[model samples]
Target: MRIAIIPARGGSKRIPRKNIKDFCGKPIIAYPIEAALNSGVVDKVIVSTDDEEIASIARQYGAETPFVRSSRLADDYTGTVAVIRDAILQLQQIGWTLTECACIYATTPLLNSERIAEAYQLLFDSHADFIFTCARFSFPIQRALLKTDQGGVIPFDPPSVPKRSQDLPPTFHDAGQLYWAAVETWMDPAKHIYSADSRMLLLPERLVQDIDTQEDWEHAELLYKVMQSLGQ
Candidate 1:
């Protein structure tokens, strides 16, 4: 069975209670829970959180909290992979048989069921260890600029300064919204998520937002409003 696991730990520093924070009239975590439940590709939806409040909110949105996440895995130093792996193990311990899984972030309010379903299908068709969302950079990274200590602008790649924008190859970054992986792939510690064995599902830049601060939260709200206005 394929399941969607959402890890939402408490003690958020940049944005307190960010997982359950109101976004467009609903909790931010509700989006992923709903998307996973509606995706049809997933057989189950689970939310692994250390806080009871988050678990309650997740249950309210039709997701199961089979176990409360431990403090060790909930720390800031712990990476997303660790949380996902832990969730899988806990679920298995509880007699749940999972074949494949998707790690959907708790704060991705812009995520939709269509995208989740598409990624789930790609995981099967491509037979990749991991399939995650990604978006192209707005500008070429070859001509990236950097500010020196003396407040002077300098090209990151000085040799590529003269190259035309069209000549540079396109680059993409992880959208941080969702990731699908086989059960064993997620269990293996040596399996790098960004390696060649993994495939990326491209998403439009308009739907990607990495919110880490107050300003970022505000910008995301504005973007969400605009997207909603256009019926996206």
Candidate 2:
């Protein structure tokens, strides 16, 4: 069996009640829940959250909250892997024979069923420990600068200062959307998602945004609206 676990803790400090906050027309978490269900790749869609309201909203969007997330794993310090691991263990305790798992973020309003399905296919074909979404840096990271205490600017990578942007290798960052992994891999705590064995599905910058603050939330809503207008 395949499952998608969405970790949506309610203690969002930057953006209050971010997990179930309205986005576009529905709760932000609704997007991923709908995407996972619509994808048809996973056998179940589970929302691992500590908030009752979050659980209620998730169920309304076709996701099941089989178990309430622990307060230990709901804090800001808890990492994604630990939350996913806990959910998997809980499912196992409830007699679920999970073969594969995907961790889909609740705040990803731009996520679609196509990308979720594509990532699952890639994970199956690559036989890798994990698959996640990422996007290329709009500017050359190698030429980045740092501000000194005196307000003076300095090159972060001095050696790359003289190199042309085209000559430098490209760099990518986590799009903070979804991660696909086999059940066995997810159960192993030592198996980090950033390992070399993990594969990444690249997405365009316009389709990726991390909604951590109010500004980010506004930006994502606008971006999502534009994409919808274009029928993307």
Candidate 3:
């Protein structure tokens, strides 16, 4: 079985109840649930959450809540890999057979079926252990600046300060939207997802947003509204 696991614990400090919070219209988690269901790639869409409210909302959006997340794995220090691993293991314990899985963030309001399908195709065709979304930095990260304790600015990478933006090597960062991996990769803790064996599905910067703060949430709302208006 191909599954899509969404990790959405309730203890959010930056944005309270962010996983299920309303984004444009419906709960933010609804976007990923709909995308995964519409993609035709995943046979099961499951949500791993400790919050009853979140689980309820997930079920309303057509995702299965096989089990409530254990408090041990829902702590703030728990990593994404751990949550996904726990879900995969629990499914196996229940006698469900899983081949590949996709970890889709519950807060990605702009996530679509197209991107999810693209990542799954790449993972299969490239025979990669993992595949995920990535986006290029608008500016060269090598020329980034940092503030000193005294309020003075300093170049983070001194060597790159003299080089033009185009002269520096292009770099991409995780879009933080989705990750597709084989069941074996999820079982193997030592297999990091960013290694050369994995592949990336690059998305335009306009489609990427890390919604952490209120300002970020507002910005994403605007972007989502525009996309909706464009009928995209």
TM, every model: 0.96, 0.98, 0.97
Root-mean-square deviation of every model? 1.1, 0.8, 1.1
Estimate, for each residue in 76-189, the C-alpha lDDT of model 3 and write its tens digit. Answer: 899999999999999999999999999999988888998899999999999988999999988899989999999999999999999988899999999999999999998897
Give per-residue CA lDDT, model 2, range 5-114, as digits (tens): 99999999989999999898899999999999999897889999999999999999999999999999998799998999899999999998889999999999899999
Candidates 1 and 2, the one with greater lDDT: 2
Point out where model 1 deviates above 4 Å.
Answer: none
For model 2, where is the 10-residue window of minimal lDDT?
A: 186-195
Q: Number of clashing residue pairs in every model?
A: 0, 0, 0
lDDT of each: 0.92, 0.94, 0.93
Candidate 3, residue 54: Cα displacement in angstroms equals 0.9
Clashes of 3: 0
**What 10-residue stretch in candidate 3 is worst by lDDT?**
17-26
Colliding residue pairs in candidate 3 = none
True-structure lDDT of candidate 1: 0.92
- Give the distance in Å from residue 25's predicted Cα in candidate 1 to where it truly belongs: 0.9
Candidates sorted on lDDT, descending: 2, 3, 1
